[model samples]
Target: MNEGKLPEWLHCNKCNAFINSLSNDSRLYILECTHIVCKKCAFARQRQSGNVLCPVCGTTCAAKCIGGDELPHDVQLFMDQSMVLSELDRLRYCVQVTLLAQLR
Candidate 1:
């Protein structure tokens, strides 16, 4: 795989980091809020308090799991779509800023 291309399933929504999803010793956690997070970030949040909130939605009911397979299909699809839209919006903002700078 290219160094700059991350597997879709390995994208962590919390820290925006690419993680190894296939490692047996990997410590990735999937939240009930449909957010994927690295173990280090999850633990850090928990250490700051007794419960860990979903970094994406600020929900306090997230459960730690290895994957998001248990989520309902509709929920999963919605999450994926939201992530894509978020990325597109960010790219659009960057492009707009670049164009404005050139015109100034």
Candidate 2:
């Protein structure tokens, strides 16, 4: 599908936020009727309604998450921080073990 520039007012119907078509960090799910929605909003709607339906067109469409590699910047940053904390915990454990051995 052609990734054309989304109109300025083309916001997610659920969240009412701009779809951020300019950023690779924002994921969007396009409905069969050409309506676009953000990933989070789409998932929430699917959970609430038990089916994915286009809010604008009232058409049932498959809600597939797009932009897997383009997750929101804040989310990506949080994942990075979590990984760093996990590594630090592992290193601290190793250091404690070494110090205990020396004391013994």
Candidate 3:
């Protein structure tokens, strides 16, 4: 993920609440329209307006739209940190190899 991008994505698009900031029982839903919402708001919208629409793009979702394991905040954070660490390790290795090649 780009710098600060994962942080941006880990928030409910509707309420703008941080994913981790939500209650432990709260579930996160990712919309096909590339939006995300907390289960509370999702159910509320469905109960009130009788449809599951993307709060961001206003796109309609299928009847069972909230069942994806996609990019949970914890997993996304792990992945992002792993990527940065891997790149740093690679650069460190290159520097070591270059030093060894220089014979000094």
Best by lDDT: 1
Residues 78-102 of candidate 3 have per-residue lDDT tens digits of: 2456687988899999999999999
Better of 1 and 2 by TM-score: 1
lDDT of 2 by residue, 1-104 (tens): 12333444456766687764545456666665666678666655463555676766677777643334443332222233556688789999999999999999
**Candidate 3: lDDT of 78?**
27
Cα lDDT of model 1 by residue, 1-104, tens digit:
22222245665677777664534344466676767777666655563445677667777755554533453232333235566688789999999999999999
The clash count for each model shown is 0, 0, 0
Off by over 4 Å in 3: 1-9, 21-24, 47-51, 63-78, 83-104
Model 3 lDDT-worst window of ten: 62-71
Per-candidate TM vs. native?
Answer: 0.44, 0.37, 0.47
Judge candidate 1 against the unseen true structure and give its global Cα lDDT, from 0 to 1: 0.59
- Residue runs of model 2 more than 4 Å from their true location after superposition: 1-10, 21-26, 47-51, 64-104
What local distance difference test score does each model get?
0.59, 0.58, 0.59
